[model samples]
Target: MVQSGNQNKRETDGGTSLESYTVRDPERFALNLARALEEAGKAAAAWSRPREAGEKPDTMAEPLADMVKTFSKLTEYWMSDPARALEAQTRLFSSYMGIWANSIRRMSGEPAEGEPVEPEAGDKRFQDPDWATHAFFDFLKQAYLVTSRWASDLVENAEGLDEQSRHKARFYVRQVSEALSPTNFIMTNPQLLRETFESDGENLVRGMRMLAEDIAAGKGELRLRQSDYSKFELGRNLATTPGKVVARSDLAEIIQYAPASQTVLRRPLLIVPPWINKFYVLDLNPERSFIRWAVEQGHTVFVVSWVNPDERHGNKGWDEYFREGIEFGLDTIAERTGERQVNVLGYCVGGTLLAASLALMAQETDDRIASATLLTTQVDFTHAGDLKVFADEEQVEAIDRAMKEKGYLEGSRMATAFNMLRARDLIWPYVVNNYLRGRDPLPFDLLYWNADSTRMAAANHSYYLRNCYLENNLAKGRATLCGKRLSLAEVKVPVYNLATIEDHIAPAKSVFTGSRLFGGPVEFVLAGSGHIAGVVNPPGLNKYQHWIGGALGESLEGWLETAQAAAGSWWPHWQAWIEKLDDTRVPARKLDRRKKMLGEAPGEYVRARV
Candidate 1:
């Protein structure tokens, strides 16, 4: 099992053995209260400001107004449906009373009816032995659960808010509730108390130091334990696959892997990974490297390593990415391999760009692309998942202004937004371990790669938000790139699409919608796991399963119903499909150099920090 410095300690008495139960520094609480009051006063002043004639309104104003209107309607509904409200109140009261009665019975050494209450599977706060036997702790835990359940029910039953508004409201309510949990405070958490007693309050001092260091490291608001970059060096332990940088441009570097097989497919494979992250994710370690796997499968593999943008690239737009990134990658691959046609695979945002490029290529009657594969990509952003919360007009405008000032969106800023989506898993765990409990975060390869994000150009990011997220022009056939209007329907190449069931960034259903937009023969695969896991799924791990079906017709539900379940990674299936596309095998050709070879694989561009 993985070890943690802040793991809970067991007491000899079978109860929490703490020398002190109260906080040692009461002045800290006072300071916190004063800070909160000052912030509240500032907010009140800001709220009182009058709107300018043509100035845009505050982004939060509409949501706050909707919440007020929702509460008003809820009040009326509660009055109209007295019985329902009464029943809800009665249930809440009964739940509290039941906890109290159980506590009393346990205190008196009497057996209570049924089993004692246990925390939910995801809740690790009450896992301490004290909560199981201590009457006060047990009661507190039960009370919190009952109240949390009541609040959730109230939000679920609330009326007047549209689906989007309700979702936002629920998400915010969850954040508030999570923040108020007892585990976050030193007084209530057994782990914190235990650490304090064991370290004689040194743990808290160290925690404060750590917090200061984090703030100094430019993560004050995000509260994440910054990954130590020195631990994992690129092209050493991380991106270790042997390859050569065959071509370079302002936007990307093309890495062509050395062939593992005696003969390879005539048509080379070109991979387009998202520019928001380094390309090493696909070429991580030899065992988990999809690039290595494809090379082993006897297909010549080529991947695009996107440049981490800076001020110099602030003016680059989607048109530039298409012209200098994807198009350039394809041309370089064809030129090096001396092949007229190539198979292409795009992952996440790269897939979106690839689809747009294909549409433009089709419009111009360019038929170089033989087949297309999109991994966890969304072309139709109508239901683009939780990330849409950050794509609103006001939020986008604010981001645009920030990008204008900085020349690009900072990597840390984008990472923070993504972490908020799964805060419990990605954010709070680090806060508790690194700040509250004074423990260092475990070294995780995926998390390290995730933290190593890249910045986006200001013009490109703004256009992406407005055109893709805000207006959804690509699906409607109105998106223009490089002076050409493009549509997904115009692309007639054979397509293979993959979506993960639990992907929060690109919802499977949204991905499913893209399959319908294709006019050519399409194969849709549904893998089990989140966005990264599903895409990086290697064979023989037996970690997750995937589903495949015939053409996805008009409905996602119908496609799922007719899909066939498979017990292994979808990589083998993808290989089978690729093999069928081309049967002519030729001897593997070595890189001829001829001024095309730039350097070794996992080149210098990926190492450029934002």
Candidate 2:
């Protein structure tokens, strides 16, 4: 029995010895080397002939093929890990140098103007697939070849590497080489490539100097341009509708815009834009501007521009926003226009506030408002989407802490947050492309507009996040505004609500759900595309999708009963609905102003940096 036990222990020890063997089998190594050599010979033979007769392969193909051969050779050169340190250090230095060079190019904006940056497609120098899809692929090809040679050398020298370590090192080397490939350069550094080409290789230093000079010149020009209201003159036939500064409130300085065009509506129109951003989003350039479009549409247009918040207004809350911002602006428009009942168009957040104002007006029997049109507005907060993520207690508190220190939330901070939501699509892809590819991205006006941003008052942001998003009281008919328990059900005026299907901020379902809360006739429209484009969408540019509901009788149930379905851009449909309310075509009279002129068109507050 002792002899048998000793024999068993010897057998077990023998098995363990085989497992613990560190050296690779000589025969296996020889066989792998032979196979690799055979493959390389075959590849060389294949390379000698054309894949297609008289058609040349890309310049990168040969280098890439050679790199592949080198990689295969590396797999067979297994050696101790520590013995490969010098080779590894050399590769590391090369990689570090490459990265440093790329960084310098980015900081200085060097590569863009100096050369024909290669296509990003098939480039490995970039980290993102989008960057790889750009036009700078050739630059990536060159970078890859050099990186591959260095990596292959590192793999060839070694002494103590086990199978696992060798395999891991080989794989990582291949990956890193592929990532840094000249072909991949476009993909890796798309932003750099794009910017380089676009700017014609203008360095950052030169660009900054030019920018400073231009800004200084612009400032001087602007100072001379800005004077008395009457002294200022517009270059184009732009807006025949003379605008007069009517009233100045705590938060907004109201201006009544009266167009000289033929009128198709009896009641005057008052445009209420959200205070969250500068009101000029509606009054942008003459062609695409909604305000300009309204004037061309022969409607009596009036816009209320809000006073941007600063340190002095840090403590102002929602109550102040309502009483001072909304009510004050409305009264001024009413007084200046002499129109007892004005048709109101409230866009985005301003629409919600407009609804609240209507409820307040109903309570006070205020007959100034005739009809209300809400564009891309949300009263329901149950599904406000990602914006609600910031509504959590912890996040909100953190934001408040940051805002408290700054007095107001920075516009750049807001822009950064929204940009992060689509970092790959909106931000990072361009960065990698321009910085890595040594090119310039396409300059898009819409992108430029999207880039422009403004800050939100800390007090307003806090209250809005808490009351509307977290508590969700607005849709519940329990929201209090200006010391009144505002109820959507109490609003009996004709209501027109426009929504978009792909709106990231306000989903259509949320907007539709709140339809039940309104007591009067409700027309809910679900437009195609996203929040901004859908609202600004004009006919013939793109087709829009929407659903229409019949007029809501006095009861909410009655509205749901007649709520029929339809489809198309709600603009025309909305136009028809609004047309029905006008009754007669009344000539637009010039609006009257009570207060003396203070500043220019698009008041100083609108121009103020938040």
Question: By lDDT, who's the top model here?
Answer: 1
* Candidate 1's TM-score: 0.86
Assess candidate 2 and give its TM-score to the true structure. Answer: 0.60
* CA RMSD per model (angstroms): 6.4, 22.3
Clashes of 2: 72
* TM-scores of the models, in the order given: 0.86, 0.60
Task: Kindly give the number of clashing pairs for every candidate.
Answer: 0, 72
Q: Rate the local accuracy (lDDT) of all candidates.
A: 0.79, 0.59
Residue 239, candidate 2: C-alpha displacement in angstroms: 9.9
Q: For model 2, how does the per-residue alpha-carbon lDDT over 459-501 read when each residue is reduced to its tens digit?
A: 9878777778778788776778778888888899999988777
How do the residues 482-590 of candidate 1 rate in per-residue lDDT, one tens digit apiece? 9999878889999999999999899999999888888788889999998999989899687799999744777778888889899879999999998888868999967
Residue 156, model 1: lDDT of 82
The C-alpha stretches of model 2 lying farther than 4 A from their native spots are 1-242, 437-444, 540-542, 550-569, 591-595
